[model samples]
Target chain A: MLKIFSTQLAGIFQNIEKSSEEAVEDAARLLAQSLVSDGTVYFHGTDEMMAVAYEGVTGPNAIPSSHFYDEKTALTAMDTVIVSARFAACEKSAAIAGAAREAGTRTIFIGAAEKGTDLDSLPYDVVLDTKAVRGLIPQDDGTRTALPSAICGLYVYQALHITVSEYLEEI
Target chain B: MLKIFSTQLAGIFQNIEKSSEEAVEDAARLLAQSLVSDGTVYFHGTDEMMAVAYEGVTGPNAIPSSHFYDEKTALTAMDTVIVSARFAACEKSAAIAGAAREAGTRTIFIGAAEKGTDLDSLPYDVVLDTKAVRGLIPQDDGTRTALPSAICGLYVYQALHITVSEYLEEI
Candidate 1:
């Protein structure tokens, strides 16, 4: 079962790498610009997705971010916020994206692009599809285990990190 | 590069699943017992690996844990501390693992078992190898990009989550 799941994940990541390459590069360009301009980059998300934000902030290009449960965090015009979500269909993510837009802050969203979801209407400047594979693994009770969004989000982050590094070097 | 990296990850995860099966299962059983007995499960780590702790606390069968940067948080005798580290060679992880052991709290570590490292001497009751694959991807500079420990740590968390859920059902 674990082997099957790992293989499925490898396939999912490859698909995402192909499909989201342009968007990921675009996001890295924007993020690199923000960092070079001395603007703070904030990462936000709920539940397990918060790990993406936490991981981003602690890495080499350290950014400022909010905690998973800290919904009261304020945004500023000079800030660039990256919001990661499993479905990108939740109220909290929408609220943050909406508020960031209103506050004249740039917003980049990374998550599953579920069809017919309100995420389409959110005011994000960039959207990197997490490409979550639903029903990826069939379980004993007839249900399927969806791939964890954190891994997908982290993969995207890795791409962004590499591109951002290259962009920084170019600048 | 991404495709090759993903394939390497799948193989690494499979190896971890096979080699660490008993230890992962053992940790799950202990964690399940703790949850059933109303004991708090605390996840801890530093830097990127901190995501593992945050991920563990936010998911279903949610546990109580401290943030990686919050070194002041106190633990109790009834608590269980799960520490995730890339190298497991840092002072903070060592300190936390040691303190938890002295406090009579069970400690479980998830990270690479670097040969000849102090990790072998840590006070963890169980150590699930993150099995970080060194030299997995060769760079232009002739250095290999070690597989990110965060991904391996998250994979272990997923395994533990599944096994714990099963154990919970049985109990």
Candidate 2:
């Protein structure tokens, strides 16, 4: 079971790699601008997706000037905000991104954009898909389990972190 | 760079799958005991490792009776606490597990046990190594970055979640 899970997880990671380069690079550039301009990059994640935000704020290689997004945080056009969730259907994340974008803060949305979900219609500066719309393992009850959104989100975060670091080095 | 990061991430996941099965099952059984006994299973993590605790507490398939560990939360023999960190050298995680054990709570430790680190010596009910002691990507300065402790931690959490679900189904 774990072997299968690992294989499928590898597939998800590969999918992100194969398709998310442009988005990742674009996010890095937008986020890097904030870092260079002394504007903060705030992160928010709904539910377990908070892992990704926490990674941005406290990971060993955390991006500089990153903080967890707060409801009271006042944003400016030069700032950037990232909102992550297991699925793009999360209204809270969508609302937060919507509000942030309206404030002229660059917004990046990260997670699985499932079919028929309202997440697809939401506009953001960049959207990096994890491509994990459902759990990888099949159970005896015919339901899927082991939906690892946090892992996928963290993978995206790390990729973006590395790209941002590279972008900073080039500047 | 993202390609290299994906490949290295896959290797780390494979390493955990290959080597951490027994520990994962042991951790699952220990955690399951708390669920069956009407005892709370508390989770604590240092730094970005909090992603694991958040996953356990707020995840869609969160284990019954799981909560984020609070310093003030009292424990009993029936209760279990899982502490995670990026490396075994995190004294804060060790201290939390030690105190929990002293209170007669079953304790599980999760993270990478780097060679010659104190984490290897700290005793717990189970130690699930993430096999991610260093960052996967090397930099121009010959240093490594992209240390994805949270991603590794979440993978372990998902595996344990699946195993515990299986264990409960068997019962």
Error of 2 at A16 (Å): 1.0
Question: What is the C-alpha lDDT profile of model 1 across B42-114, one tens digit per residue?
Answer: 8886777876776777643244332333457576666678887777676677788898878787888888888
Clashes of 1: 0
Local lDDT at A43 for model 2: 92
All candidates: DockQ: 0.46, 0.82
Q: Per-residue lDDT tens digits of candidate 2, residues A59-109?
A: 887889998999999999989999998888778988998999889999999
Local accuracy by lDDT, each model:
0.73, 0.87
| Each model's chain A TM-score | 0.88, 0.96
lDDT of 2 by residue, B1-171 (tens): 878888888889888888889999999999888889898999898889999889989987687898899889988989999899998778898889889989899988878888887554785889889888888888778988888688888888888988998898888
Q: Which stretches of candidate 1 lie over 4 Å from their true place?
A: A60-78, A133-136, B60-78, B133-137, B144-147
Task: State in Å the error of residue B48, model 1.
Answer: 1.7
